[model samples]
Target: FTVVNRNVVFMKELVNKTINLAKLNSDKIPFNIETISLTDEIKNSVVNNQVLFEENDIVVENHVIDEIYVEADHILLQELLNNLITNAVKYSLEEGGSISIDAVQKTGSSDIIVSISDTGIGMESSQIKQAFNEFYKADDSRHNLDSSGLGLNICKRIVEKHGGKIWVESPGKNQGSTFYFTLKKVKKEPLKQKETSISSI
Candidate 1:
């Protein structure tokens, strides 16, 4: 049953990924942008994957400011974070490990940088460079996992569309990895449009 269920889930993810790629290629991906609370979005993503986290006994540490806000498409941003956390869980140690998510306002910049770090199988420098490439897998076959390798690539596209950047880092294999991305921050208050009243004769 577990195998069957995992396969089914993998198939669904693949289908959705194909559709997303199609939208990206045709330039028809619509984004509903608005001021959103980053903390809430991140928490929602975490909740969505609660089952997987529990199954693995992984501890997730969220270091986010509840008041931090960003101008972005809530759905897309959630997907981006979901992909990162999913990847972290996928490559994590079998004995269970810790994952930390942090969001900080970049110094001297208008971007909010978010990072997901995991104590799992890490990647080499060369693999880090091509991590965002479509269908690129870092490990040869330490663990047999069903992955299309398009997750990070799609994440890169989503971040770029938001005028942000995404990257990964690792000291070396067995040292663990951290994925980071940035998004434009928004002030606590939305920008108000100036109103002009016309006088009628």
Candidate 2:
């Protein structure tokens, strides 16, 4: 009875917070999205045939920075990113696995994709959907965890709100998961309107 009551309260809080975010109505905008750079790549690990990387520290992959920018709520973007990373850390193994972030341009489209992947305890099918529910918890659909069960939902809203899409996929339970969000590429210049004469003079 007590646990159920607490879950109810958590759900309410999430709804309220989401509503506020709607009022503020500021989108996340990112600039300087490079592709030819890995901000956090290993330098002294490769020798003959081996790769070594460290965990716990944020790794920035170096690659050719793509020429594309997105307009969004900066703060919301951070919140969404932080939420995913936090979840990854919260459910990660004691030894830790890996948290990777990458950005690339999608072919045949003017959009950029930012992906965050983690090697942590993956969710079951039931838990997967509940992860975004206002009060959907693994056990009770609501708990006293740091999240208000609105993190992913907020992320989904933010992405779609910005004319983008967000989704999640995993191998299965205890495997791992990757969360990806996309931002439409802004054309540097738009074509100008043409004036047509009734007849060519």
Per-candidate TM vs. native?
0.88, 0.59
Candidate 1 vs. truth: CA RMSD? 7.1
Each model's lDDT: 0.82, 0.54
Per-residue alpha-carbon lDDT of candidate 2 for residues 117-199, written as tens digits (9 for 90 to 100): 77766777767766665544333221123356566766676566556788777777668777788876555553333332111
Worst 10 residues of 1 by lDDT: 192-201
Q: Write the per-residue lDDT of candidate 1 for residues 1-201, one digit (tens) a residue.
A: 488997898799888987776665554445667788898898888889998788887899988856788888767788898889988888888788889999988899988889999999899998999999988877642233568788888898888877789999999998999999999888888644333221111
Residue range with the least summed lDDT across 10 consecutive positions in model 2: 40-49
Query: Candidate 1, which segments miss by more than 4 Å at Cα?
Result: 140-145, 191-201
Give residue 51's error in model 2 in angstroms. 25
Q: lDDT score of model 2?
A: 0.54
Model 2: residues with Cα > 4 Å off, grouped in runs: 1-68, 138-145, 187-201
